[model samples]
Target: MFTLIAAMDENRLIGTGRGGLPWSGITRDKQHFRDYTAGKSLLIGRRTFEEMRGWFRREDRPIVMTRNPDYDPGGHCRVAGDLDDVLALAADSDGEEIVVCGGAELYRLTLPFADRLVLTLLHADFPAREGGVFFPEWENEDFVELRREDFAADNQASPSMTFLYLARRAGSEHADC
Candidate 1:
């Protein structure tokens, strides 16, 4: 199965222009990411992969998607030239779930193939950074919510958020993202 995972604010802002998240200190959301992605085959864009350097665990199989033919992410990751290559790699995984870890572009490219979405929806909005990275838009009608857990703000440090798990509805057409 292919899963798309991300955290976005109400405005769908996923990252700052500098390739970092705008908000921080959401402990449960951090743990949610770790728990959901652990041991999964990760399909990530080069920029996001670079931003997350040194955070990968030994068991995580990351396939970095980039258009540059000569791009190398060293020996740690397997590189894919395009979405087709990424899909081929995912196909070869022996029943392991392929999680598309993001940057907006990767999420857009892989949305059609996503069987599920695991999202952390923050209740508040942050100022949109100049050239901020937003999550790609997808049709919510195409997926059915499987689970949802709302978290109240613990302090001023983090806003309330919801952990939402959704799966593509059976017989739903793949809407172009």
Candidate 2:
């Protein structure tokens, strides 16, 4: 199965800049991300991979998508030329699910193939142009929310957060919208 995971602000902003995230102090959210993706195979964009240079553990398998055929990821992580190559690698993986880790373009490109979405929604909005890179717009009707947990604002971050697990409903069409 294919899964997409991300943390976004109220405005659906997944990123604040090219190489950084908007909010920094999401300790719990970070743990959730690690726990959920630890043993899975990840498909991430080159920029995302660069931003996460040393963060990956030994057990994690990361496939970076990039157009440069000679780009070296400098670790066990592999490189793919495009989404089709990423999917082909995932198809050969032994993991239970393949996680689509981000950078806006990769998310938009793979949304149609995702079976599940694991999102952490921050309750605050960081307005656009503050380096806002959006998560692709999606329809709620396409997936069934399987679980939700709310976390109160903590010392590390001011905004409360909600963790949502959604599975694409069987028979739902995967449209471009």
Candidate 3:
């Protein structure tokens, strides 16, 4: 399953800068990402790839989609210049699943290509944040609630966090990797 895993807020904000993941000061979000992506192939944008160097040195390594070919992170981090190239690489990989990590524009581009979504909904309204990116809409009916964890208001992580494991309806995918 090609899955998109992201932590987001109610107002539809993911990040503000070029490629920042705007999770509201939640430590659990990092854990969530790390756990889900531990032994998998993580797809990311150019800036995200740069920010997250040496973190995803998993057995499978990670694939990064960027505009530059000079991005040589060495060891396991492969760069795909565009969506088609990224899809092609994913298509050929032996792994049954791929984790689509984001930086906004990359997420939007990946939406149409994904078969599942692993989302974290943070129930805290944020103040005036700078311009950021949002996740593309996938209807509620298309998801299956696999796991959910709720946090108290004073919790160090978040007030109320919901982890969603959403599978695209059968036959939604054009091809399988």
Candidate 4:
């Protein structure tokens, strides 16, 4: 199974486009991400993988997607040259879920093949940075909400969040990956 997981604000602001998140320090959201991705093979873009350097666990298998054939992520993770390679990895996952963790491009590239989407929606907004990265546009008709959990902000500094889980609707059309 392929699952696309991410957290975005009301404006869908996900990244600074310079290898950072627009918002940070939400303990609940971080925990939510870790819980969903644990034990899953991760399909991440090169930039996103680099931004997450040293944050992976020994059991977390990551396949970094990049166009550079010689790019190595220092043996901590493997690399995939393109979407074809990513698809093959997913094909061989057996029953293991392959989580599509992102930079925007990777999410846009893998969204079509996602069996499920696990998203964290923050009840707040942040200014869009110059060259900011936003989550790719998706149609709600293509998926059905399976679950949701709402969490109020921990303090005045944090934003309230909603953990949402959705599965691709039966008969929904998806492009072959």
User: What is the lDDT for 17 in model 1?
Assistant: 88
In terms of TM-score, which candidate is strongest? 4
Score each candidate by Cα lDDT: 0.86, 0.86, 0.72, 0.86
Write one digit per residue (lDDT tens) for candidate 1, span 72-163.
88766889997668767867776358899998988988888788999999999898787789988878889999999998998786789999
Show the lowest summed lDDT stretch of 10 residues, model 3.
Answer: 168-177
Off by over 4 Å in 1: 175-177
Report the Cα lDDT for residue 61, model 3.
54
Worst 10-residue lDDT window, candidate 1: 87-96
- What is the per-residue lDDT of model 4 for residues 77-123, given as tens digits with 9 covering 90 to 100? 87899877876775676526789999899899888888899999999
Clashing residue pairs, candidate 2?
Answer: none
Residue 10 of model 1 has an lDDT of 97
Model 3 vs. true fold: TM: 0.82
Question: How many clashing pairs per prediction, in order?
Answer: 0, 0, 0, 0
User: What does candidate 2's lDDT look like per residue over 15-114, in tens digits?
Assistant: 8664588878678989999999997899899998988899999999999999999999987898899766766777777665889899898899889888
| Alpha carbon lDDT at 67, candidate 4 | 92
Tell me each candidate's TM-score.
0.92, 0.92, 0.82, 0.94
Work out how many backbone clashes candidate 2 has: 0
